[model samples]
Structure formats: structure tokens, C-alpha cells
Target: MATIRIGLDRLPPAARAAVEAHTGPLLTVEETAEGFNSEIAARVTSATGTWHIKGLRADHPRAWTQRREAAIAPFLTGLGPALRWREEVAGWDLLGFDVLNGRHADYAPGSADLPEVASLLCRLGETPCPSIELRHAEQRLEHYVVRPDLRFFAGPHLLHTDLNNANVLVGDHAAEGDRARLVDWAWATRGAAWLDAGYWVIWLIAAGHTPVSAERWAAEIPSWHTAPAEGITAFAAANANVWSEISTADPDPWTLRLADAASAWYAHRRTG
Candidate 1:
């Protein structure tokens, strides 16, 4: 479910003051509309520097997501934006991140951004999972996947399960090694390395690729080969079930689209 958004000025005086302490006096505040997780998401600038700030009320149900992102940020140096500061004051938990000057990835077929995204995921595949408290993929999918199939989703690799195109930012330098960076690590998980590729297949389908074509792109990531055919099929069905529930609870267009995409992918894999 999407959190209700509010502007930076709506923050409590103490909360706003605490933020200004890190970033001098605020000169401009631009609220971003790309993400659904944070109630407060905006780019703020001061004499010192510019940063993207995301926050939630300390008592909000999803406040732990802020902690999770802060805990995982240090381990994601090249793969994600750096976390510059964190503040918990006046009933809010806030995090400040270095702003990335990039655009959301274009997932449509034939877009130049595809290869860059593949490169980013390839780099992520090699990163070792940090020894921090993290969600386990098999546990997350346990209710949707059969018990026996759970083993297929277990692994030591750090996985960013959410593959929404908007979460990826493609920078100007295409030739550079780390030209793309992922954002929104709130759902970061410990799972089978290949599972992230599996999740990407769904978003690619939602972005207009057929299941066959999406799997072809997933093959570009080396770890995609590590997944067994049956495991892939099982993962597809599990996501189909997951999206069904999500769309039922919140029938937003994007959720419905993903639900349909997951069903299409599951059908393709089941019939093969």
C-alpha cells in the first residue's frame, strides 16, 4: 500500500530543525513522486549540499523500513546512493541520502537502458551479503510457495527483491562500470542470487516484454544460469499468487498490471 505523502515543510519544527543541522539552511525542497514506500520523499538543498530525504513517523507501522535502509546503506557503496545522515526526533525517523543525478530506468523493449540495468544487476550479483539482520526470501514466499520448493529460494547472496524500474537510476556515463544505481533498499533480502533476476522478469513483462523475452534478458545475468528450470517455474507461480493478493487488497493499476504479468509468466512456465 502507498503511504500518504507530505511535504518537507509539513514536518514538525523540531524535526525540520534537526534536518537543517545536517544540511545548513534549506534553500529549496522538491517533492518526488516516484516511490510509494516513504511518506516523506523529497530533494532538499542547503548552502552545504543537496540530499534526498525520506522519513516516516516514528510510530508508523513501516518505520522499521527506515532502519533497514540505514543498516544496509553502507554495504551498497557503488550499487546504491550513499546514506549521509539519520535523525530520530520529534516523533519521526528520517534518513538523508546523497542525491543521484539520474533518470529512472527505461524497461521497454529496445531501450538503451536495458543493457545498463543488466550491468547493474551483474555487479549486484557479485556483492557478498552483509552479516546484518535481513529478511529471508524463502520465508517471505513461504505462504505462497510449497514447502518443498522453499529450498530453491534459499541462498547466501544479498538480494534486492523489488525490481520496479523506477527504483533503478541510470546515470549519464554509459561506458563507466557502475553507471546505474538502485534506490529504495527497504525490501532488501537474503536469498538465492538468481531470484533477483526472476523478480526482474516480472517487471520486464509489466513493461511490455513477453515472458519468453524477459527470460532471455534474465539470461544476461550470469547467476540466472544457477537457477534450475523447476525452481524458476515455482518462483513464477509464487509471484503470481503474491501479486494476486496484492492486487486484491489494493487494485491499483500498477498492481493489477503486475498481477496480470505474473499470471502470464506463470502460465508460460507451467505450460512449457
Candidate 2:
């Protein structure tokens, strides 16, 4: 799902006009090369202020992601970028957010950023799931988890299952603790409190953490410590299957790497 790279000037006239109404003529545009689903993704400087603008064509396969992000963003508290405004013009949907000035998080073992990531996970654990109906863990993983145990994944906690390092930002601007922010909420779910940490372990491995070290990182979140081992086992097996299917379907370098990581973590859990 490659997003079409588009700048402020690339937007349709109506869409461009709608955005410029809030932000004046774009003085500078810095386009982003990452993200799997966005036709327009960039940081634009205008007379008003800099805003991170992202959007997709109305009929694109992943167009709903922008809407989902906007719908759940307010409930995120401080977890992700604030959605200042949104608009649809010329068959494209767009969103504007206050640009965050932070580096993408480093997930390497022993990096100081891990603690901030853990802290953000802890903060999210405390956020009661919003009333918005979200996919339950069991439902979302139904195809992957063999003999799925509904009890193992039951809960009402909001879960940000996709914690890719790129979606996280860490910086030294905070008054005391490490400053970290989570983004890309399209895959956010409602599940047991421990599920997000469980998912992070896979990403940690993908970023070069041995399974033991990755589990150590997961342990930093209180929910991880208290999570039932059976639930963890279920999630591990399910995720391994999910990643395997993704790798098989795409076979892209990243998908292959993550498949291996998920398999490695599953093997670790099986042995210990």
C-alpha cells in the first residue's frame, strides 16, 4: 500500500485552496518518504505555522485510515499528534496536525529511548478505552490464533498494536522524564492492557533485540508483569501466524525481516 507522494502544490486546486484558507501560502514543503498509506504526506511551512499534513484519495483502499485517525485522535490524550482540522476537497481527504519536532524513536537495545517508550505504554494503559466500538483482540486475531481463547484476550483497554519505531518520537524537550509520543493510530484496538507490550516485543526483536532483552523491555510496563502467561502465549502464537502470512503475501524485505523476528520470539516463548 504505497502512498502517492504529494506536496502542498500537488493537491487539487480546491483541496489546496481549502488548506491555504487555514494556513496561508505554503512557504516551504518538506515531503516525507515513509508511511504505507498516504497520497499526501508532508510538513508544510505557512504564514500561520508549520503543520504536518497527510491525506489520501477518497477512493484509495486505505482512505478510511485518515478518518479513523481523526475519529480516535481526541481520545488519545497526549499519545499522538493533535488533530487541528480536517477537510475533503477534489476527491481527497486531508488532515492537519501541529508538527512534532522530535526524532523517530530508536528501539535498539540499551537505548535511552526504551524507557520513554515504556513510559508512554504505561500512560496509555491508564487511558480507559473510549466508548467508540473497536475491534476486540480475539476478533482481530481470529484468523491467526488457533483455537482462540476468548477469555485470554478479553478487556476494554485501548491498545495501540502497531508501535513501529518510526511511529514513535522521542526528544529531550521534556521538563524531566523522557519525552515520547506515539502516532499512527489506524490499527489501534481495544484489548487487554498487556497486548500492546506483547506486540512491542516483536518490534523490539525486529530492531535487533534478542528475545530475552525484548522481554526485559516488555517487563518495564506493569501490565506486562501481571499478564497471564497463557494470554501471552496466545498472542505470541497469533502474531507469529499473522507475520508469517504477511511475509508470505508480500515477501518484501521488511515483511520478511519482521516474519523472522516474530518466529524467533515465538520460538523463545516456546522454549521458556
Candidate 3:
């Protein structure tokens, strides 16, 4: 019998068997362009119906990474349909969901589904971060702060961290259903809520829409730099030494501009 390669070899035996049994005569298997994490998409046929199997790579040190989909699946079931099913015999973290039969980026700013997409993001943000150890807030500030080449904005909020457009899937639905669904949750992290917004803003600008110009983008940086100090004085006071290095790794021009703007804003606030 021919074998279906769904990349589930590392899952527990029960989970592996479940995938193999469900995915019969795997007609095709290939990697998906969804996220940075290793993911494989497989199409298989069975007596009951055809199925798509999404198997995440198990080669990472973080066990939580592999279980992310299953962890959030239950919470998102009613909010958005959840189609993930797994087996214990299989050693991989495999999730089987209905294959989306449409383009992922079809929905844009004016699309009727834009508000729903934003709403979904707001809801996802509401789901508290899992118990995985997060980088210390001060440490994050230190790493991104000191490099004279970058600027830092400090705040404590949960962020998706990576919500670029490609991760959003746009599909046709029944006349009254949601037309867009957001997927891929591997980079979820606890940070500034505006960090997610800022990142998406950059993505949108890079994609060629002029939502915020260079000047407005430049102006927002200083406001962010001053934000943490305004509300969380104690935290900012404690972390002041490390904040200087926070923006070091972020070499992107827009990020640098924002950092510069923030630095100027900080200086102005101190004097006035």
C-alpha cells in the first residue's frame, strides 16, 4: 500500500495513526505558505470524503508551539468554525479543517468583511496568553533600546506579534456568514497592543496603501515612547536603564523613523 506523507511521524503514536487512517492515498502533499513555522498541507481521499491535513513541524524546542492550534481551537469554535481533529496514535500535531476554497487576500480595506476581521482580531487579543514563559519586559526593552540606531516604545499588552496580511484568509460564505477568517496563531505574545497595530500599519504601508504618511508615521513614534512613562511610572522608572536598547534590532526604516520621532517626543516632554 502506498503511504501518505503528511509529516506526522513525530506525533504520538495514536495521533500518527489517526492521521494516516483518515488520509488515505494522499493524492498530494506540500508545504503551505501560511507561517514561518514548518507546515505541510496534504490532500487525501477516503470512503467518506476528501480531507485536508495540516501538520506542523515538530522539530522545535517549544512543545507549546505544536499544540497552539488545538489549544485555541476550542475557544474559537463558536467565534469562528473550528475544524481541527487529531488522533493520539499519530506523533504529530495534526489538525484537519475544511479546506478553504478561495483566495486568502481577496478582502481589502473597503471589503464588507473588514470590520469582522478587525473584530476577530480584537476577540483573539482578548484571549489571554498561554502560560509559556515570556521574555521579561525589561529584557525586551533592553534588547530593543540601547542601539543608538533604534528607538523604543514601552507598554504592557498582549499582541499577536505577527498579523501580516497573508495570514488572513478571505473566502465566500453563505449569504449571511462571515467572509473572512484569520488563522495562524504561532507568534502570539504579550506586549504592547499598539505593537500589533503598528506592525499591521507598517505592513499596509509597505503593501502600497497610504493610510499613514511618512510624517504622521514619524510623529506617532514619540507619543509611543512617552506612553509607558505616563501610565506605568513605577515600571518605567525601574526599567529606564534597559529602555535605551529596545529598538536596536529593528532596522526597518519606518521603525527607525518612529524611534527617532519618539526620541524627539521624549525630549520635548521633558522640557515642556
Candidate 4:
């Protein structure tokens, strides 16, 4: 099967109109292939200065995007260079951020950097945000996770859920110890924190790791699982969902163990 590609011209006319309105004449439009959802990266001169435009398709209700951007924008602004402005028009969410010199997916994680990434996950998971209604988690688990029709796991928590290697961007001239920036917040959600950590850990393991690498990841799992029982259970279920889809090997051991653990944890939490 040919892989589906997201391109700039794929934007609906209404969405394009919105982008043109904010970004004057577009000097160039580059389709960014870094996200699960269809996204476009455009370079255009505006009244202020040159800007990077990220346009996202509205998969859910329009209000959801507005609410989500509003909820997380303040938190993400100073943590790293983030979207400076956002507008929803037609069936898309258009955002503008300063044009930073970098490319996504270039950061290669070393054994030493694994802990730092884990620590960053802890920071993101621990940070609190206003509770938003997460009706999608239940629907995702039911339709996608349990059914095994979809390979991706949709877990609970306000997770930057799609934090794979590709989503990370670093300067081309970045030194050895410079911090990397994270983009792509389309999959952000509220649920289990460990799900995000587990997702990365599992990906690292799948990317062909040595015994030492495996041991390091194994040791870090507990820290990711530090959330309360309910949160942990939700994360475990999310992990199982993703594993069922993308794992090359039979997921009997991991899936069964995770499912049992999640069930037991939830039951215990309910009783307590």
C-alpha cells in the first residue's frame, strides 16, 4: 500500500483563505511529513515579520481545538518556542509561531540522553492543567484499542501523545548538551501520564536496542508509572492498545500482563 502523504495544497479552500489572510503572500509552502495528522508548514511574510504557519485539520469539533489550544498555550509558550497565534476557520486550526531555524526528527537519543528524555516526560506529566472533558479517551479505547482495528494507542492524560523521535526538533548547530524543542500538539490529551513514557520506551526498544539499552529502559519504567492507580491503569491500557497494533512480535506476554495489571489496579482504586 502506498503511504498517504500530507501536503500543503490539501488544505480546504476556506482554510487556505484563513492562512492567506494572516500571512499575506506566501513565499513558500512546505508540507511537513512529521505528524500523524495532516499538517502544513508555510513560510510567509506578514505585517510583523517572517512567520512559520502550522495548519491542522479539524478531526473533532471545532470547539475542542479552541479549548485545547487555550488550555495548553500558556503552559507551552515559555517552555520552548511555541505557537504565537492560533485561529480556527472552516474545518481547520491554523497556528503561527516564530520561524525557528531547525528541523524535526534529527535528534538521535543516546543512552545518556534517555534519562533526560524520561525526566522531561516526568516534567510534562507532573505539570497540572485545567481539567477538560475527555470523552474521546473512552471512545478511542472502545473503538480502536479493544477492537484491534487500529494500531495506535489512544491513552488518557493531557499527553503530547505523539512524542516520537520525529516530533523533536533541534538546531542544526546545536551543541552536545542543548535542549531540544517538541512540536505537534494535535494528539495532546488528558489521561494517564505513563502512557506517554511507555510509548517512547517501547519505541526505543523496537528501534533495535542492545541489552544495556533494554536494561536502562526497564529501570526507567517505574518512574513513568509513578502516577496514581487510576492514572497508571489508564496508561497501561493505552500501552496495550498501541502494542497490539505495531509490535512485530506476538504481544502475548506484554499485552496480557499489562491488561491484568490495569484491571487489577482499577478495581483496587475503585474499592479504596
The whole-model lDDT of each prediction reads: 0.95, 0.86, 0.47, 0.53
Query: 3 or 4, which is superior by lDDT?
Result: 4
**Which stretches of model 3 miss by more than 4 angstroms?**
1-16, 23-31, 43-45, 49-52, 56-64, 78-83, 87-91, 106-116, 125-142, 146-158, 174-177, 211-272
Leading candidate by lDDT: 1
> What total of clashing residue pairs does each candidate reach?
0, 0, 31, 8
Candidate 3: worst 10 consecutive residues by lDDT? 234-243
- List model 2 lDDT by residue over 1-272, tens digit each: 35657676777899999988889998998988768778788898988799998889899888878888888889876788899999988998999988878998999988888989999999999888888857788788888776556567778899988888989988787843448988788887888899999999999999999999999999989999778887787788888999999889889999998999999998888888
> Which residue window of length 10 is worst by lDDT in model 1?
171-180
lDDT tens digits, residue span 1-272, model 3 = 11133343445656655775766544444445345454445544555555556665454344365466566556554233366576433334566765555455532434454454455455554556455544433344444334431223343554454445666666666333345555655555556544544444444444443433322332333323433434322222223322234346645664454344444333433443
Query: TM-score of model 2 relative to the true fold?
Result: 0.96
Residue lDDT tens for model 1, 117-169: 89899999999999999999999999998899999999999999999999999
lDDT of 4 at 24: 70
lDDT of 3: 0.47
C-alpha RMSD of each candidate structure in angstroms: 0.9, 1.4, 8.5, 8.0
lDDT of 2: 0.86
Best TM-score among the predictions, by candidate number: 1
Model 1: what TM-score? Answer: 0.98
Q: Once model 2 is optimally superposed onto the true structure by TM-score, how far is the C-alpha of residue 231 displaced, in angstroms?
A: 1.3
